[model samples]
Target: MDSKAEQQLASIANISNQKERTTSYLALLSTLFSSQPPSKDALITLGRHFVTSMSMAMVVGRRVLGSYVIALCAGTSMDTTGTASITLDDEGSGENQQFMQAGINAFKSSEGEEVRRDVVEGVLAGGNLSGWCEEQTTVLRHLYAHLLQLEEDWLGAAKALMQIPLEGGSRLISDEEKLAVYIKIVRLLLECGEWGQAQTYFSRASLLIHVTKDKETNLSYKLSQARLFDFSARFNEAAQKYHEVSFDSAIAEEDRLQMLKAAVTTSILAPAGPQRSRILATLNRDDRVHSSLPPSLSTMLRKMLLEYIVRQEEVKEFEAGLEDHQRATVEGGGTVLERAVREHNVGACGKVYDNISFEALGNILNLDAENAENTARRMIEQCRLRAWIDQPLHLLYFESRSSHDTDAEAQGTAGGLGIENKEKEVEPRLWSERWDDRIRETSIKVEALAEQIQQKGLIPPIPA
Candidate 1:
């Protein structure tokens, strides 16, 4: 026999028991790797000879053997691309493909957390290698991300997925695959409060969302968008997206309910405006609000929709159910929920009174008089409130404005409803102007008659 065959036979013979041959063969491979590094061809030969043994290594539940198998498959000394010097050839040979696939299968089938972690750490220690088969690398990275998730290392999981080269790699990826990875990265980043990063991937996912027919992928994309909106403090958009996702039949009943609850919370947190009023009205009218939603959320929604002033106790109740980000302090002042409530309370005051003293508004909103005035001033300047402040009198005058009135100025007379609504809204203002003119003209005529009467001696005049 040739020297190589003789050496293999001697290695097998050294395994005193046949039952432990898989373990012994793995140990022999480990010994070779521990010594001088073998050539790529030599490693391939050794893998071909003992691939079956590596496949069965996990069945025996030996940690050291499993570690050796991972190193043999993934490599201990990896290059910048994570490709080991002894990596499978790029020739696309069936044997090379089979060898890598078997290594992946063995790594996956193994239940040892330490071994799984070792495999992930080994690959991550070097950068992700594009030269490896895309399919194999993709599966391994996803597996590592799953392990990270189990440990609650959300940022780590997201970073692991970021290693995937969806657009430029050894293989071309489908839209479905890209969407799946982008959505997962968004979700994991959101979990760790990485809003900026989450938004970046969310944009990528949105492009592929229409391309995929996958119900789950579509649902996840929508959910991620809602979350990104929430974290970014785009509450109205978040509320709308959450409401749309909540009603999806594909989602589990429990998860659907949670989404509904999120919708309600975000709706309440949205700025007090016509858009929010429309959403509040929709939510309040939904049968689910009173039935499936908690009483506090339903109650808050009802108050907001009806323009009732939210009390401190009710605000506290709502706050108790808020997520950390929901309660996060925002620019200009208090928590996001607090700012929403303050704005809503000011609007509620507007609904109940044509004008109110800043002091009284401050008392109602639990803010100082100056702060209350500033809040109303900001809302008015933003056009969110159709009211003005009388700085001298320290009062806020609420204007009874409608969407039709603002829509004209914003959209112009561009035909359709704009023309019809403009005419209706304009007529009332025109009548007010005409009434003032008539009063001024009538007063001038009466004054002239009085002067003539006095001059003609028809009436007595007082001496100066």
Candidate 2:
């Protein structure tokens, strides 16, 4: 056997428990190698052998073997121009119909467009006046584009494109031509909410066609898939896919930013029950959720994640407290234990207040003295411990002019009044208000921090 064949055989042999398969492939490779300037028949035989072998390997869960088989198949030679873009004109003759049918069949079954294009080009270049080249070329290009759009048939389209002859074999169309085909396919699938299927096609097309290998194409495809998954309530899958495309090395920074935006937006909309939990778990496992994003973006996402966790914990605690309060109120019926429990809960609230250094809590109580004073006091304590207000607060305080100041102004007095005017402080009531908002804000912070750790860890995005 030739050195290449021997190397392939050795590589196969090294894989676990595939000696028999390797030997069989080696024998086939040797047979093909023996034929100098190998005949088309010999090439076809080798190709068939490799395809069958690879299919079997996959069935046996030997992916490594399958990969090798695929490599062999990729290197195999077939009729480069099987589907000639030539239309034979006949005056309403059955032969014309037959020719058209043959051409269509060849187009459908052709393994790769580039290969088919080669065959067709060779036939046309042979100086044969028998075939119609112009009509066939146009029709084939259109068919190529159309087939590429079908989500379920993308693999077939890729195989077809690879066979097409470019330059002399098949015409080299514009990037717009290829893009138009993909766009049509994606739009159709998207409208039908077949995002997963659409994405599969989009990715295949990107890999197969050079024209589709752009930042816009990748970003659009990934973002669209993310949206579809998000709408379907598949948060984890959506987030994972988003991370893959958004942080890809091939993608430009601007595109990455756009992807990040989409990812964050989708994460926010993700349902907070089991779905969010699963997504977070997946993110942790993949290390994508915590990895290096744009500095500003990383900070934001980390903050979000941290805040989310904190809010979730707070909710659980509150729910537990509520349940306990209800149980005690119902079972104790004015008993000493019930009173003691109530007192303990109230005292716990006070302890929380003493921990905060900010006087904003006091200010809130003073403003809403009549109705919100007691609740405000309880919240002040809760904010100190549970609200995580350890960082500098960014709240805006609004103050009102005192009565003396108004009187002094009316009297045309420029001098200052003895009493200072008080400002209305909008302190973030950490322990009270809409539960959803609190949870959302906290989650955002946590997610942001988690993003930071992930980037610092230097982890790759998880594969699909």
Candidate 3:
């Protein structure tokens, strides 16, 4: 056997009961290192050997064996690109496909799909690079990332992808490809509410991708920025970013519309009046909602929310379009129709009724007086509505303005939906303030580019 095979054997042989694990690794690595042609049978047998080793290793708590398997797989790559992406489902009858299919059939009659998935997961869990050589570390990480992906473990997948050193074969994986995959996995975690783990990956993807100047990458960075705000509950900022995504021609229309709706929906949940009106004005001008194109459910629902927020009177119109599931997606575990009615009441209360008893408020909102009070309390607690519920009087005092003014432009409104505070505060952000931010960011980028040029001696350094 070659030095590599001998080293692999010695590595696993230290374990208390190394016979089973040793046999599997020896056969696999022997085939991998042999002078003979790299056959499909050998590759398939290696996969089965990997499974047997892992299953036994897992039983004995000797997952260290799987790490060696990862190293072996790294050196081999299962020759997968030549075989794996082409599944039996594909119509092609190429030589590689036939061989891969034959391999699958061979495995199917022995160890089923479930066992194979378990083996992949075991390798992923055990493939840490604590003692791996420098070259093999990159190869191992590339292999590990795919294994994690197969198991749908996005967080692990992102970390493994980033582990590939830039100088190796792994570096051939461009910033574009790596960031795209990394961002996707992070986004999945973000959507699934795994914030603690997801946040680290998001920041990593952002810092890495930001230095690249690709339009698609920039869009991805922007999407990540939007996700940060959305997940953090910075409604106005999140909505603004989502709105930007909606208009980006680089993104698909279907994706853009979903983002647009997310923008408007989150906007409605922003402080009422000018903040909402600003988003509403943008949505109002976005004739896509009223376009003659085929309406996806998200587009249709987004339009419903848009109309409901702007009109603040058509509770029935909005409710009419909702299916049971859509209606049930309201915050506080209430139906959308129910929430819409409460929102209509809040808007109406802000505009028409300054201070009203709970029973009367409920009548206007089409709810019983007690339920109205409870709903108002919940909405108040959630900061959804600017109001205070008086238990003694069974009354709700609609707040003159949102008690907090975080977004600078959020303070002002011309229409009678609520108070009109036109003075822009330094603390809050308006569209003009956001534009200034853009200019500052652009200036920074230009300065950075100039510094890069000067450092390379391409041009004389600028005087301080």
Best by TM-score: 1
lDDT of 3 by residue, 1-464 (tens): 13544455446546566556545554554444332233333333333333334234432222333333332343222323201111111222232332333334433433333343343344334443332233333444555566556667766766665554443542244565556656755765664456566677777676578556778667867887787776665666887899888889887778887787676655644444345545555554567745722344235334433333333344444445432333445555455545644664565566556788877876766678877787777766655566665576777777565545433234243442444555432233354765586599999999999889888999875689
Clashes of 3: 3
The residue pairs that clash in candidate 1, if any, are none
Scored by Cα lDDT, where does model 2 land?
0.41
Looking at model 3, the pairs that clash are 327-336, 408-428, 408-429
Most lDDT-accurate candidate? 1
* TM-score (C-alpha, index-matched) for candidate 1: 0.68
List candidate 2 segments past 4 Å from native.
Answer: 1-184, 187-227, 273-304, 307-464
Tell me each candidate's TM-score.
0.68, 0.25, 0.51
Return the candidate ranking by lDDT, descending: 1, 3, 2
- Scored by Cα lDDT, where does model 1 land? 0.68
lDDT of each: 0.68, 0.41, 0.52
**Per-candidate total of colliding backbone pairs:** 0, 59, 3
Residue lDDT tens for model 1, 313-396: 999988999999898897777999889999999988976899999999999988899999999988876667767676788989
